[model samples]
Structures are given as structure tokens and as C-alpha cells.
Target: MGDGSLRRIAALARQDARLLARDPAPLIVRTLMPLLVMGFTQPLFRAALRAGDVPDANGAEQGVPGMAVVFLFLLVNVVGFAMFREHGWHTWDRLRAGPARSFELVAGHVLVALAAALAQLAVVLGVGGALSGLRVRGSWPALAVVGVPLALCVVMAGMALVALCRSISQLTVAANLLALLLAGLGGALTPLSVLPDWARPLAPGVPSYWAMRGFSTVVLDGGGVVDVLLPAAVLCGFAAGLTVVTLVFFRSAHPKLTWS
Candidate 1:
């Protein structure tokens, strides 16, 4: 990329960060909402597990681990909030018309989203440790290795949505609906084993499923770095595929129009 292009991308990132910081609602929803949900739901989920309404594979030990997956799914949805906000302000259109390349613009947003995801992940992990006594048997390095790329995939998925959405209202509705659906199907709301057999094959296709599986393996199951490889690869593929599809859609939508 040229120096001008690089600078434009940096400027776009700075602009996005400033805009996000200025909006208290988006900030709260993106950062604090997940933590709030985790705080409130943890008790109920624990109660459910104890009541035998929800079977625990590892007895009470699964509570915190299970909640970890929930927290991660929340983080993924939160990180996608920027796309909705950008659509509202038409900032994406403006940025695309500027010196920044599509990749650079996408990259900048992904970085911001990654940072938000990591920050929320830290809060969730800390709360799990303090309140629920969740354990992390895997190396911190391995956790970070899996986490960073997952965040990137999530952000790229958000950008793809932004490119495809026709309006802010549509974007908001779609993002929330997609988040809820993915969370439910990906074992964030319930364990994969509890899902019907027909739904089993579809789980691997959803990015959240791969993410929750990878995270649970490393953090809860004490799996090694190699164990996370498949899920991580799936996430990477999702990111790449979504990026290409979004670019194509964006280009086609923004094509020059002919006037009579």
C-alpha cells in the first residue's frame, strides 16, 4: 500500500475509535452489556444445572466453563456493533470514497473490534475466576493465539454485513438476529450435545460454534495448542471468505451509474 493509503487507513481507525468513544450507548452495549448478562445469568444457569434441568458433563465444574462460551459469544456480537453504528452515520460510504483501500478499511475496523473483544474477554475471564472459580489450564500464549484470530473473523463478518445491509434499521435487526441465532446454535446458550442431531452438522458451519469449541477446549478442557488448530483454521477460512464476498458485493453496489 502507498503511504497515502496507509495514512488514510490509520485515520479511519482513529475516526472509528473516536466515534465509538463518543457514543455512550454503543460503548455500554459493546463492552458492559456482556458482562452484565454474565453476572445475571450465571446464577440461574448454576441453579438449572443443580436442578438437573440442564445436565452437566462435568458436574458443577461445567458452570464457569459453560459461561465462558456465553461470554465469548457476547463479545463477538458486541464487536460487531461498530458496523451498525457506521451504517447509521454513513461513515462506511465516506471512508470507501476516500484514499483507503477496501482491505485497509476492513483491517482498521478489525483491529478496533479485536481490541474490544480482547478487553471484554479479559473482564469475563476475570469475573469467572473471581466469582465462579473458572480455571484456565492451557498456556496464556495458546489462548491468545486462538483469541486474536477469532476476533478478526468476527470483525470481518461484521464488515461483510455492513457492505450488504441496505439501511441502519435493517442492519440492527439483522445483526441482533444473526447473533442470537448463532449463539443458540453454537452451544453458547446450550451444549452442543443437547442440540438435535439434525442441527449437529450445521454447528461446524457457524463461526461462533468453532470459536466456542476452540475456546472451551483450551480453557476448560485443558487441550493443547494443536487441539485448537482445526477450529482456528475454520475461523480463518470464514474470515477470508466473508472478506472476499463483502468486497464483491461492495464493488457491485457502488458501481458507476449511467445517466440518460
Candidate 2:
């Protein structure tokens, strides 16, 4: 890409960041809601971990990271909503007619979403630890290894949804369904060791499972960067696959509608 194109994506990313800042309620709410939920569920998580043979395990070890992963996946929908809102506001064509390519437009959204997702993860983990005793117990760099790839997966998944969905309603339903389904199947809702035998095999297919794997290794087992490499690589594979799907299905001229 040329310097000019880079500049355009940067400019659009800045604009999108500003727009996101303008409506911080969703971000604030997601952040606070997880903390509140952990308050009520940490004991339960601790009990489950104890039952799993980690007799000394505090609930925060499971509660904090699990809830963070769930919310992180939930936040993926924001990317789709942001992109679809352009069409709702009748601005997508105008933006399309501008100098930026469709790829650049989507790139801008991806950049913003990636940043927001990372920040959200950091905030949730940090505060949850401070308030709920969720310690890292391992390498901070290892945490980043898991977090960055997970964030990339989220943005790519959002882009894929935007490519596939034609209406706001469809996008909303798909994004939410995928978020919940992926989180639940991936063992974010409960530990993989505790899941029924038939469902245990399905967790590895979802990005959230790798994320939780990396996180649990760090937060619960004191594992370092080396321990997380496999999960990180798997997350990158998921992100790459989603990117291919988005590229294959997305078209600059595709029309989007706000279902009434």
C-alpha cells in the first residue's frame, strides 16, 4: 500500500475511534457488568475448581478470565454494528465513492475494533484482579500472546459477519448467537474438564477455547509464553481463516439495509 492509502486508513480509523468514544455507554456497561457478575459467581467457580482437584483454587482464577473471554467475544458484534451503521446512516455509498478502497474502509474498522477489544480485555482483567483476586500468576507477555490473537480473531469474525449479513437484524442475530454459542462451547461458561464428554470435543473448534486455554494456563497454572504458543498459533489460524472468508464474500458494491 502507498503512503497515501496508509494515511487514508489512518484518518478513517481516527474518525471511527472518535465516533466510538462518543458513545462509551456500551463499553462502560460491558466492563461493569462483568465485574458485577463475577461478584456473584466467583464462589461458584471456586467451588467447581476445587471439585476439579485444584483444592486451593480461588473462584477468581476461573471467574475473571472466563467472564473476560465471554465479554471479549460479545464485543465482536460492535464491529459489525459499526460497519452496518454506515449503511443505516446513508453514508456507506458516500464513503465508498471516496478515495479509499473498500478494503481500506474495512481495514479502518478492523483497526478500531482491535484496539477497543484489547483495551476492554486489559481493563476487565486488571480490575477483576484488583477487586476479585484474579492474579496473572505467570508471564504478562504470555497474557498478551493470548490476548492479541484473540482480539484479532474477534475483529476478523466481525468482518466476516459484515460480509455475510445483508441487514442489521440479521447481523445482530448472527453476531449474538455466534458469540454465545462460541463462548459456551469453548468452555468459557464452564471448565472443559467438567463439560459432558460429547461436548468436550467441540471446544477446540472455537477461538474462545484457545483463548481460555491460554488464559487458564497463565492465570491458574503460572505457565509462561512457551506454554501459550500453541493456543496463540491456533487463534492466529482462526483469524486467518476468517479473513479469507471475509475477503471471499465481501464486495464493495454490496448493498446493506436496516431491517425495520
Candidate 3:
């Protein structure tokens, strides 16, 4: 990237971070709710571990990663709502009045969303370790194998959806439904092994599924960094595709929107 582009992205990302910092709602909702769910699901995870001779199994492994995945979907709203937020606040036109390119602006928001995802995942996983005795049986580098690519995919996919939404209510309904649906279908709500025979085939379509698998390998199967390379590559591919879609959708919609 050119220095000019880098400067634009950095400046805009700083602005986004400031704005998001002012609102604790996203942090509270995404962070607290998942922790609560993780705590609530501890027993089931314990039972599942106990019922089987699953190697290196623990409650946190069974629960924390899935909870983290589920909340990743819910947390995407912070990124998906970027454009609609300006519209609601009556600042869209003013933002468009700025000299920055639309790509720069959009890229900044995506970076912010990625930041949120990374923080949420780390925090959730950290708490799981601290409070729930979550263990990392594999290389720490393998953790990033899942987390980084998953964050990018989630944010890019969210930005793509943002282009389709005209208002917060529309985005809210769409995000909530999509998040819940993906969580359920991607094996975040439950392990794919336990799902019905027919449903397992569909899990591969979602990035979260690969993310869950990557985490599971490291946390449950005592996998090395190489073990998760495929899942991480798959997630990076999803992020790339989603990035293309996001840019195409935003470019197509920008001219018609009041903000762009």
C-alpha cells in the first residue's frame, strides 16, 4: 500500500476507534453476554467430556471456543452498522464531504471491526482460561491460525452486508438473524459431530465452522501449528472473497447513498 493510503487508513481507523470507545454498549453486550453463556454452558461441556474418553478434553475447550465463535457473529454488528450509524446521526453527508476516498473510509471501518473481533476473541478466550480453566494444548502460534483469519472474514463479510442495509433497523434484523443462524448452523451452538447426519455437510460453508475446527485442533486435539494451517488458509480464502464482495457492493451502492 502507498504511504498516502496507509496514512488515510490509519487516520480513519483512529477516528473509528475513538468513536467506538465512546460507546460501551458494544463492548458490554459482546463481552459480557458471551462470558455469561460460557459460564452457563460449563456443565454440559463437563458432561460431554466425562461421557467420552476424548483425549485432552475439558469444559473450557468444549465451551469457550464455541461461545467465542457465537459472540463473534453477534459482535459483527459494530462493523456492519458503520454506515448506518452515520446516517442515524445525520453525519453521513458531512463524512462524504471529506476528501478521503470511499475505499479508505470503508477500509478504516473494516479495520475497526477486525479490531473488535480480535479483542472479543482474546478476551473471551482469556477469561475462559482464567475463570473456567481453559487450556491451550498446542502451539500458541496456532491460536492465531484461527483467530486472525476469522476476524478478517467476519469483518469483511459484515462490511459487505453493510452495503445492503439502508437503516439500523434493517441491519439489526439482518445481522441478528444471520448471526444466530450461522451460529446454529456452523457448529458453534453445538459440535458438528453431534448434529444430525444431513446437517454436517452444510457446516463447511461458513467461516465460523473452519474457525471452530481450527480452535478445536489446537485446544482439544493437541494440534501443532501445521495442523491448523488448512483451516486458517480456508478462513483467509473466505476473507479474501468477502473483501472482494464488500468492495464491489460498496462501490455499487455508494453513489446512491446519502453518505457516499
Candidate 4:
């Protein structure tokens, strides 16, 4: 809360940003792959939506948002690995010994992750509109209602994984599994109505489901902020819960091995 804390957080954020800039493969892959997937799968989504009674659907309505959610979740690697690499390079201890408090360190890294997630989301949406014929039928504010919380949830989920996993391999496995599970189960891969009966019921429990719901309401249904309120709130709840888990479980003293 003090100036000193703010300074520390800013400094830490700058360092992490520099590192990310130096090695940008994760960001590029996460963003580019989704666009490629959307390109190849748009026709498929269009047909599927038509079969489901959305006669006007252009596939971008489904494909664009779906790919955004899936790949945004996959960006978890950007957050989880950033922390793991700090330990891998034997810099975590040095960081801990510095003047920055634990909260400041985490906050700084989180700021960077949050910015990256939002920027990626914006790029995907912009490019989606240009390349895939995606358009927002609803309010742009409503879109942010869905996107901001979704990004926060993803960042917290990544932090939670780092807090819980003991080694680099464990973090890698858990992060990947969580991303895929959340995406698939949340209807990012397909509409919830089309998912298996058992999976449909569980869709509400995952953040991506709400994200997709909000996107559908906005991009497909032409809904406004009021329509997306529930999905945004649910995403915020998930982010808050994950944040608590990360704060409680994360420790400077925890031994995070670089490898299995």
C-alpha cells in the first residue's frame, strides 16, 4: 500500500516483462495456434450451429469465441512457467531475500500476466473479426464484462497451480490438464447443449463455461451487459476462490524443483 511497496511491485513487473519479451515463444504459440485452429474449423462450426437452429450463424460466432477461451486458458503456461523458471534459475531465493514482500512479488508477476492475457484476448478478437468475420452483436462493455473476469480467473488458476505443485513437471502436468479439462468441459470445444448429458450438468462449474456463455449471449444472441451479468459474476467468483487458494498455499520457503 505504501510507495515502497508500489515501487517494488513495479520493479518486479518490469523484470518479468523483460524476461517475457526476451523469450516470447509461449505467447506466440498460444495466440497463433488459436487463430490457425479457428481458420481451419470455422466452416465446421458454422454447419454445427446451423444444425442447432442458428440459421444465420457464420461459424465465427462459435469458432472465434471458443478458440479464444481455449487458447486463453492455455496461456496458463505463461504464468505458471514464469514462476517455475524463477526457482529453476535459483533466483527465487534471491528475490525472497530482497526488500520486496511476498505479496508484492506475487502482485507484480500477476500484473504482468493480467496485461498479457488481456492483450492476447484483444488481438484474437480483433483478428477474429477481420479474418473470420466475427462481430460483436452486443455491447463492447458487455464483452469486457466477460473478458476481464475470464483473464483474471486464468491468471489465478495459474498461480494456484504453481502454489500447489512441488516440481516443474508437476506444475506442467497439472496446468495442461486443468486448461484442457476446463476448456472441454466448459463448452469451449463445443456447445454445452451438444456435450454429453453428464458433462452438460458440470459445465456451470467451470469458468470457461460462463465465459463461453457470456460470449454467446453477446456475439451470438446480441445480448447486453444485463444478459452477461451472471456469467461475469461467476467468473469473478472463480477468480476470487483461486486467488484465496494461491495466497494460502503459496510460500517463499516452499521447495520448487526445476525438474521432476
What digit string (tens of lDDT, one per residue) describes model 2 on residues 79-129?
A: 888988888888889999999997899898899899998988998888887
42-67: candidate 3 lDDT, tens digit per residue: 77777776666564556787788889
Residue pairs clashing in model 2 are none
Question: Which ranges of candidate 4 are over 4 A from the true structure?
Answer: none
TM-score of 3: 0.91
Q: Rank the candidates by lDDT, best first.
A: 4, 2, 3, 1
Against the true structure, what is each candidate's TM-score?
Answer: 0.78, 0.97, 0.91, 0.97
Tell me each candidate's RMSD, in Å, in order: 4.9, 1.0, 2.6, 1.2
Shift in Å, residue 171, candidate 3: 1.3
TM-score quality measure for candidate 1: 0.78
Q: What is the lDDT of candidate 2?
A: 0.89
Which structure among the candidates has the greatest lDDT? 4
Candidate 1 lDDT by residue in tens digits, 202-226: 8888887887787667765678888
